[model samples]
Target: MIISRTPLRVSFCGGGSDLPAFYREHGGAVLSMSLARYVYLSMHEYFQSDGYILKYSRVETPKTLGEIEHRILRQVFEDYGIRGVDFNSSADVPAGTGLGSSSAFTVGLLNLCNAYQGRYEGRTTLAAKACEIELGKLGEPIGKQDQYGCALGGLNFIEFHPDDSVTCESVPITQAMRERLEAGLVMFYLGGTRSASEVLRKQSEQVKNSKRALGSMQAMVRQARSLRAEIMSDVDLIGPYLHEAWQRKRSLADGITNPRIDEAYERAMAAGATGGKLLGAGDAGFLLVYAPDEARAQVCAALPDCKAYDVRFDSIGTTIIYSD
Candidate 1:
């Protein structure tokens, strides 16, 4: 049996810019951190005679590639010829919570498949293949940040060039500083989930048509660069940076923030949160707040509407936790 674990990602800024609609012309960059949460995949031969035994949120027993119902799995399995194995997946969080759950699973699945074939792929290769499978083959209208972020596993500045080349630069942060930053980040769970494809599709069209949106994304990329520099010295600018970035991000597309979301943001700020933003494509997900440790308690208390928790950073990307 071989089990692969990959961490999910929280994109701090420069999100929408990673889409090809924007990056193919202007390039893209995002500062993202890998969260401790993970997607775990365990695969081994159990009952090989009948078909492929799959367990995710649902069960599947498909004897042929065409019989598979999960789009991502179907494409990956067929393209790679992966079959006749008892494969099960479980996650620390549910899908569509803006924490890059899908990409985390994709990266983990890719790693598991490679390991099954007696191959071990590096992070960049796994990330690029996962992107090709998702953005190229599956036609998910998402960006490249999640793939690289989940696979590379750190607080990094990921760049998407017009030539289709990508780069991930880790933030020069010490462990003590990392813990300090993590402490100030308080995440509140918003009730509903959103389809990232729906949101990204709209934002893609907006970026192609509106210079205002493109310009906002460009500013975000700049902020991501600036934040990288600032965080290493001291995290004094993170709160205000998040505030300014969220304000610009709201202009990318409609429905990124709703009445309920706006109310929550206001309450968080009123309770002393210096800044915060919705973690995903934005209709609904976790609201990540930046506040001093002293203010975190008040921020949580103010948001009686949402469940809150602290976030931890993960430095390990994807690993075969158990292989034999």
Candidate 2:
């Protein structure tokens, strides 16, 4: 049996820019950090060995590689020539809640498969393979941020170049600053789950035609750069920076924010949140906020309808937790 775990991420700023539609021409960057929340995958030989058994939110037993049901599992398992094994997956947070859970799952799965094959794939290659599998192979209309962020683990500034190349650089932050960030960062479950594809698809289409979308995303990339520069100088501009980015983010796409999300953000602000943004492709998911010590109570109390979480950073990207 082998199990691998990967941390989900919170995209701090610069999101829409990572889409190939924009980045392929103009390049893009995103600043994000991994959260302690994780997605885990476990694999072991099946008792009967008549077929392959897969367990996640649902269960499946497929006799052949082509018969595998879960798209990611099917792809990864087939590539690794996995069969006659029982594979089980689970997560710390529900999938598609905008914490980059899907990519984390793919990364964890890749880690597990590599170990199972008695091969070692470093974090960068693991991330690259994930992007290849998710975006290249699966044709997911998403950006490269999540895959890199999940695999690299720490706070990072990820860049997507025009030539389809990418890079991840750790933002040097003091432990005191890290703790401050962890304490001030708050997340509220705004409810429901959403597949990022539709939203991202729309955003990508707009980037080719709408200068507004492109401009907003480009500015968000600058926000990421500014944050990276300013963050190291004993300055915490994250809250207000998020505020600025959120303003631009909503304008980049139609479904990025809705009435309910708008109402919640307003309420949070009224309760003293410096700034907050929706976590995922929008519609529904968690709303992340930065509220200082004094306003934390008001921020938590104001959102009566949502469940809250304290943000903790994850440094290790993906790893094999147990094997026997």
State TM-scores per candidate.
0.98, 0.98
Colliding residue pairs in candidate 1: none
Residue 49, candidate 1: alpha-carbon lDDT: 56
Candidate 2 global TM-score:
0.98
Q: How would you encode candidate 1's per-residue C-alpha lDDT over 1-324 as one tens digit per residue? A: 999999988888888888999899989889999999999999998577557888999998888778999888888878778878898999988899899999999999999999988988899999999999999998889999999999998789899999988998988788888888998998899888878999999999988889888889889989988888788888747888888889998889997889988999999999899898889888888999998877988888899879987789989998899999
Q: Which stretches of candidate 1 lie over 4 Å from their true place?
A: none
- Model 2 lDDT per residue over 107-143, tens place: 9999999888889989999999999999988888988
Could you tell me which 10 consecutive residues in candidate 2 have the lowest summed lDDT? 228-237
Displacement of residue 255 (Cα, Å) in model 1 is 1.7
